[model samples]
Target: MRRGAKRLLLGLAAALLLSATAAAGYGWMVYRQAERAAARMYEPLAPAEPPLAYAAIPQPTRVIEAGGGLGTAGSGQSESAGRAAEPVSGPFAFASEARAQPSPEEGDPFTVLMMGVDERAHDRGRSDTMIVLGVNPARGSMLMFNIPRDTRTELVGRGTLDKINHAYAFGGVEMAVRTVERFVGERIDYYVKVNMEGFAELIDLLGGVRVDNPFAFDFEGYHYAAGEIELTGEAALMYARMRWDDPRGDLGRNARQRELLQRLLQRLVSLETLGRTGELLDAAGDHVRTNLTFASMRGLALDYGARLRDVQTTELAGRGRTIDGIWYYEVTREERDRVRRLLADQLR
Candidate 1:
């Protein structure tokens, strides 16, 4: 895999890890209510306060700027670069418009934009992985949609056609959120951002996670075989980073990432994490960033806890093409509309 692509995929795993944290923690709360003895034993493990929420996450503007790269994905295919129009350059500034916010009521649906970024040397890199998760408590379901990192769209605040991932590079979380809102035609009620390094460390903090590799391959000096495997934080970072050897390319890599996240989440909610509560909180404090407040998270957990049993995952469908010597994923308007309708129904 290209170095740039690897960077993005590694960062992507970090975002997924954080999602698992929320799901697992929420699940514990639900379990506590059903089992008094179990709750008593694990009560001390719960955080005294909710995780911190950041209104403005740090976004460094300086670093060695790197060119964009492309990778294979389940729904999108990469093509060689070709002659194309030049993209506009500048900081993005989008005006806020009136949109529906998340309701405190348990049944109301809310949307969260989860971003994993490859920031190096304090320079904020592009959001390598962008997934919009819609949790619908009323419907007892969750919808997860992956937007290819190379997706080409009107960068909402910047008014230029570029990779959707670039929004974070241009304007941090705010721009990324606006660009996605335009793409999906839905108001994002919250956002979560995770740095790659911190995410890697968090994995190590949990000892390690078990993943079933569908194919055997080597990445970053770590040899992996097809079958069930254990990955330390560092090894897991490489595991999520490698996609070049996979026949499915980006798509196959994404599947493994999802698998790891699912398994890691299951591990998080188990009684085992209770023993490492202090270390877990310390890791989260250093690595994770979110806009969701304690009250909101509690509401989501208590109200939507049982509803989380059903989850549906989907990826944006697009064809990759090179323009102006740059690779871009071109998605159709109809596809955008379809996603919009699906989310609208869920939100309603």
Candidate 2:
């Protein structure tokens, strides 16, 4: 062969080899990204107990032991106090009684109360988005439950009947988790509180995500057509935030939020996302807060990751009513029981 032809053949062979190598290692790359993301994303629970003994306080209706079940008993704060203080920054004066729950393990189906808060300056923010994700590793399946923000329920610790999202505004993650647990009649294994503004940065970090828009409408200056569109972080935030124009109102908004989240999860674990690990970590650091530790994250990646591929989402069925001139979503007792049984069966 001529020298030029031989050189061209060599280059082609090299390109093919590189392509094969990348294809073979794509899954491994994604796994590593998950591992790394999980590590940065592990934000442990640090309850702000006002120098009170854990034993002296009345245990929450559902008790979940924290710190790997060793339990923090006395007055020693974590060295990373600044970081620990961020998630629970709400007026927790009356929230001293709330405690963390035990971390779930492999084969143990666990529930997580996901709070997506629209925090404002100096305010802990209302949990505009509330979701319950049930992970059953043994069964290899995932379940999602959307709790309407306006749902009127007894605030677990505050002991007031208010909007379900008020728990977060009143007492932060601990109160939110406890309130949701009591409301659902199940112990929440974990909680992931996300700052809505920061979450937009996260969505942007993932280079945005694609979702099927159910209806075409203009929301907060962002326009959507009746079809699939790739949403930027800001646009995605708007996509999840709008509800007034929808005929179904909050219910319609909730459906869109769930769809966006489901798509976001799928994108997070993709090979494309693996390439943006640094951006992902940056977004996680600024926006996300969770009680999942490094060890438990590893377990999640190893045991539950595969099962999460096929997710089943359920919306808490309820009716809207005005109480004392304020709107509330009144979920029927029968509906709550049905959901409870469904989750229980999945966990089993």
Candidate 3:
């Protein structure tokens, strides 16, 4: 992972933690505040035109009910049609008829593409961090992995082979999502994008996090002992940013990021943090963007939160290569296919 990649993964971790706050069973006032915050964070991606190569790939078919459950395409009317007949209230308000009528014993399996963008003034920066998560509440498990930012692949909408992260820089979230869907050979059910710069503030608001350092090292004037330790926002930022001193280099830094992420997630979901809903939502509203509606989030929390206890993670294998005097992470066809199958099985 490079500097931008490291920064974005932190943003992803914080965004996920804050998003889970919607399921904490808050009172009406807190729920209303969450609804308002969700409204600010909502930025739906426009429909994308698939690339030529992906024309034959059978994309997954799913109808997202207003209540966030999965239904067949012919199960009911469109969400927009349902909205048109009713007065819009809060973000959670949905017409009763449009709600999903899934089997009581079944659980919806869905995929999410989470991106950390390195946006700056006057530039729609690249997706420095790209991760895919497959959640199956019925199995009480999840599949997750990261796509290296420097990987060379088809840029989808742009019709040229280039670094995968460049899709965001060229066409924003729509193109990024299109490119990734083609890469994984599946349709992404939802997306969450976060600007990396705001991640530190989010960590601070959560009262910091705990990480088990594998080795004792000092970077940017912060000394970390080799054991379980607590870090302030700034210290944690530095902790994830150091790679040169690490013998494993980017790989070591990546592991640290994952460890820190797990810690933050545990802290966010704990009973102790439930009282700080307003502050958490406020921080998230400023830095996060997603297509998930408030109603859907609440439904997921209530329905799937308890069942989703087992988590599994894997890495996409690739090797560094230089092409035309530029460095890129090149993944083989076999490797890509293996990952696609893993995701496909999870969804099934």
- Candidate 3 lDDT over residue span 1-348, tens digit each: 235334535444443534444534777788778888888888887765433233121112355766998754322333232222111111221121122322312467777788877777898878877878877878877787777778767777676667888999998998888888777666676788877766666677777778899999998788999999988777887888787889977566666766665566557656666766688787778778888767666666567655665767777787665444566666665676688778878876
TM-score of each: 0.71, 0.71, 0.79
**Global lDDT of each candidate:** 0.59, 0.58, 0.67
The 10 consecutive residues of candidate 3 with the worst lDDT sum are 87-96
Q: Give the best candidate by TM-score.
A: 3
Candidate 2, residues 133-177: lDDT per residue as tens digits? 777767778787788878877676776667888888898887787
- Provide the lDDT at 295 for model 1: 45
Candidate 2: stretches off by over 4 Å: 1-43, 46-105
Ranked by TM-score, the better of candidates 2 and 3 is 3
Model 1 worst lDDT window (10 residues) = 51-60
The true-versus-predicted C-alpha distance at residue 183 of model 1, in Å, is 0.9
Q: Which stretches of candidate 3 lie over 4 Å from their true place?
A: 1-24, 49-106
- Candidate 3 residue pairs that clash: none
Number of colliding residue pairs in each model? 4, 2, 0
Candidate 2 structure lDDT: 0.58
